[model samples]
Target: MDKYAIIKIGSTQYKIHEGDTLTVDNQNGKVDAEVLLFSDGKTTILGDPTVKDAHVKIKITGAVRGEKIVVGRFKSKSRYRKGRGYRDTLSELLIEKIELGGKKATEEKSIDEAPKKAVEAKPIKAEKKVSKKEPAKKVVKIKKPVKKGTK
Candidate 1:
């Protein structure tokens, strides 16, 4: 059972655990932030503003730039228009560990687990077979025929 924590980095808060990777607004290099809350399914600890000596350890794995967002402005009857694009810089962080009062919550797990293989279904046998000779056409019979008589 691993403990999880909600921590604040800059202005944003994120729920994280050991070995969890997250993307946050641009940060240079590694960072350590205080935990706001901690829980391990059964037991929970809440911090007054922030927990004492509880922190999340993180390191910047990579820098990411978000897709460019286009903005446009238009005015009616004035022939006015404006266009702009914006891209935000983001930081990719790997949560190294979470500690509370000098005790580690979870151990780093290795990425050596085998991948699941998809089960192959057996092929179905074909029911109808093709033949060179033309088959006979099916004819539906009428139950009763009307007799032609002089009215």
Candidate 2:
């Protein structure tokens, strides 16, 4: 059965399958995107705007920048010319899994993994330490007004 799905990432739509690596606009960290459509060779499902309980798990592999493009501006009969270069920031993502209708397409370790034991932590008691040195006294300053000379 075909395991392809149409998913939206940022402002772009991508047709991806399991283990597909896609480079898209820079995204912060790994994110889950909504699946717009999904097909399994014989059966196909579509979402109303977006599929309910369907999502694509993507892991951001790395960040990349496109090749620099040089832009130049000049006016006829004028010596004024300006040039600048820019690069588009891109992020590499790996399609980890796609779930349709609350069902995972890929088998995960959530169910098979052993349960973690909760460790009981003892409450710490803090004791105030008393120092043998005497506390320093604060000095108060008295301000005296200067007497004005009689005219």
Q: Residue-wise lDDT of candidate 2 within 1-151, one digit each (tens)?
A: 7688898877789999989998888777645576889887887888898877666777788999988999999998989899999999989988877667665443345767889999999999999998899899999999999999998
lDDT by residue for model 1 (65-110), tens: 9889999999999999999999999999998877767643333345
What is the lDDT of every predicted structure here? 0.83, 0.81
TM-score computed on alpha carbons, candidate 2:
0.65
Model 2, position 133: C-alpha lDDT score: 92
Candidate 2, which segments miss by more than 4 Å at Cα?
A: 30-32, 103-151
Candidate 2, 26: how far from true, in Å?
0.6
